[model samples]
Target: ATTATGGTVPLTDALELAQQGLPWLMVFDHAGVPLHLGRTKRLATPAQRLALIAALRGCSRPGCDAPASLCAVHHVRDWNTHGDTDIENLTLACDRCHAMVHDGPGGWKTVTLDQDSQFPGRTGWIAPPHIDPTATPRVNHRHHTSELLATTLARIHEQRNQEREQRQRWLSSHTRHTHAA
Candidate 1:
């Protein structure tokens, strides 16, 4: 494993550094020659997706009203363009927003922001040569609105609790039926 400074260390040490917030490059070497390119087939795991939904609460598009379950995970950068498939690059977008990202009226650039109007998180901006060059760029905030976020969290908790209770009831009914048999 190599740190950003070009110093080599054990893989465990590199992972520890990364967990501590230091970015590291993953490289494959053969005979002291670099063999791997800076690309990865990354996808947010199911657990990560659930956590992301709980965090953001829904689609990240500013005006979108779609719920998290109805949104699709989007990569900020295209994998073809050598983007990593990780949470750092992932956000949920509704179908319309996703279409605008891939094929749109104006070219859209996905961005990670320090802070935004809705939240201090990810965003998207229109690039030059856009259809409405005179229009002010707008950022989507469906997932970033603090007010909606609170409600979303409540909804998620309620949904989970309901599902848990349903499962428990099913299990108890099954157990009772088995004992009677």
Candidate 2:
């Protein structure tokens, strides 16, 4: 690996330096090239990285609190699996979380949630079957407390509205039957 100044450094050493809050290091791709290109189909551009940083405050995996600066641009669908480098298919994941994602039985799987999801257009991490029998997808709200609160409040409100509607229908039917009798 090479730092932004063109000094060659081992990958593990670079990671350690970054964790120590080194402000000058720039992450490079597997080819040891800096990922600053504005238009690249493989690596994310600077603008794309900024967009992801804006959208996700930290790693998208559950129980992780790594900040966006320490996170890498990850492909929700594996790049080797014919997934494109589109912004919609990308997410932020810390190095540890990124390594945990795979197709193996014990690995975590990530998916892009739809509009109907609690966190639309976000990455949802699905646990292995042994961890969750139903394989339910979960989002990391650790970085966004307001979103969690909003989702909880919306669910509660929807449930109450449904119950109220059901009760009104029952009362209307009962009144109609009484009048007919």
Q: Which one wins on lDDT?
A: 2
- Candidate 1 C-alpha lDDT tens digits along 53-156: 54445667667777777778788777688777776677777787777775445655566555544434554545445454653445555434445666699899
Compared with the true structure, what per-residue lDDT tens digits does model 2 show for residues 6-121?
23578898678767875334443432234543333544466667556656757889889888878999999899998878888998999999998988769999999898986678
The estimated TM-scores of all candidates read: 0.46, 0.64
Output the TM-score of candidate 1. Answer: 0.46
Q: Clashes per prediction?
A: 4, 0
Instruction: Give the residue spans of candidate 1 off by over 4 A.
Output: 1-44, 103-105, 115-119, 127-139, 147-181
**Stretches > 4 Å off in candidate 2:** 1-44, 159-181
Cα lDDT, model 2, residue 127: 89
Error of 2 at 172 (Å): 7.0
Look at candidate 2 and tell me the lDDT of residue 99.
Answer: 91
